[model samples]
Target: MATYSSNDFRPGLKIMFEGEPYAIESSEFVKPGKGQAFARVKMRRLLTGSRVEKTFKSTDSAEGADVVDTNLNYLYNDGEFYHFMHPESFEQFPVEEKTVSDAAKWLQDNAECIVTLWNGRPIAVQPPNFIEAEVVETDPGLKGDTAGTGGKPAKLSTGAVVKVPLFVQEGEVVKVDTRSGEYVSRVK
Candidate 1:
């Protein structure tokens, strides 16, 4: 197994800590006048999506995790698991609900998504940055309200509710930013 020293700590770096795979979220180097330099790392456990903070000396090292990210097309959810297919090989697999997590809201049939695998098992799922979904329910647009100044909550076909501009109405397709859950624009 490969090892990562403190110098290699950075956001997105995956390593094994306490027998679990963790992805580094942030790393800060602290140098005090009284003692040796150390690094403070904030990482998320890939298997359970839990966050943890650890301090390491400058010379400390950790084993690298056998993590791989693959692009897969999302099929659908069967209430118990979410199905995905490999684009090239057409091999299909089912991922647990916990592994899909919040990304489940953005999943659409045949949409591309990144699946993180640890030792050949799915650990996490990342939906695309932008998703175009139809507004299934929302207040009717008022007359002369095309200025888009105020916003109202709109429920999407995928079950995610986001604030859309005043001019938006039900049944209109709108693009949303998955990272922040913000409405981008109406799909033409």
Candidate 2:
């Protein structure tokens, strides 16, 4: 295994600690008048999404994590797990619900995503920033209501509910910002 010294600590650097993989969220170097320099690091565990902080001496080193990011297409879900397939390699894997909860709202069949792998198994998934979904159900918009003034909750085809302007109606396709789960605009 490869090792990275405190000098190499930085955001986005992946390392192995306590037998698990972690991504360095942030690292700061601190030097005192009479003490040895150290690096304070905040890292998030790849499998559980938990964060921890630790201080390491300037000469301390950590093993590099065997992590990789791969592009995959969303396949069908069977309740327990969400399946994905690599476009070129045709590799398929099942991701647990807890690992995908954050991105579940934006998931659509055949959608493209980036899957983070640790030791060749999935640890996290990232969906596209924006998605276009059709409204499946929502109350009727008042005749005179405009798109700017007010909004109502609408159910989408993907089963995620989002607030849409009053003018949006059932069966209409709208663009949504996946990061915020907010309505962007009506799809033309």
Candidate 3:
């Protein structure tokens, strides 16, 4: 296995700590005037999605984790697991609900997603940054409400609700930012 030193700490770097894989969310080097310099790291556990902070001395090093991110197509969910397949290879992987996390809200059949694997097992799933989904339910747009000023909550076909512009009507396909769950624009 490879190893990473404190100097190499950076966001998205995967390392093994306490026998578990953690992806570094942020790393800051602190050099005080009193004693030694250390790196403060904020990382998220691969399996649990929990965040933790750790301090490492300048010379400290940690083993590199066997983490890989692959492009996969979203399949159907079987209640217990969400299935995904490689576009070319057609190899399928079943991921747990906890591993899919918040990305489940944006997932649709045949949607492209990034699946993070740790040691050949699915650890996390990430939907595309932007998705176009049809609005399934929302309050009726009032007459002459084309100013796009106020907003109303609209439920999408994928079971995610987001605030849409006043002019947005139900059954319209709208582009959404999955990361922030914000409405982007009405699709043509």
Off by over 4 Å in 2: 141-149
Q: Could you estimate the TM-score for every candidate?
A: 0.95, 0.86, 0.95
lDDT: worst 10-residue window of model 2: 142-151
lDDT by residue for model 2 (1-188), tens: 78999989989999999999999999999998998999999999989998999999999999999999888999988999999999999989899999897898889999999899987889999898899999999999988776565999999998899999898999999999988899999999
> How many Å off is the CA of 103 in candidate 2?
1.6
Residue ranges of candidate 1 with Cα displaced over 4 Å: 144-149
TM-score of 2: 0.86
lDDT of 3 by residue, 99-179 (tens): 998999999999999999988999999999999999999999887776655889999999999999887888899999999
Model 1 error, position 4 (Å): 0.8
lDDT against the true structure, each candidate: 0.94, 0.92, 0.95
Q: List RMSD in Å for every model shown.
A: 1.8, 2.5, 1.8
How much is 26 displaced in model 2, in angstroms?
1.9
Top model number, lDDT: 3
lDDT, candidate 1, 26-113, per-residue tens: 9999999999999999999999999999999999999999999999999989999999999999999899998899999999999999
C-alpha positional error of residue 75 in candidate 2 after TM-score superposition, expressed in Å: 0.9
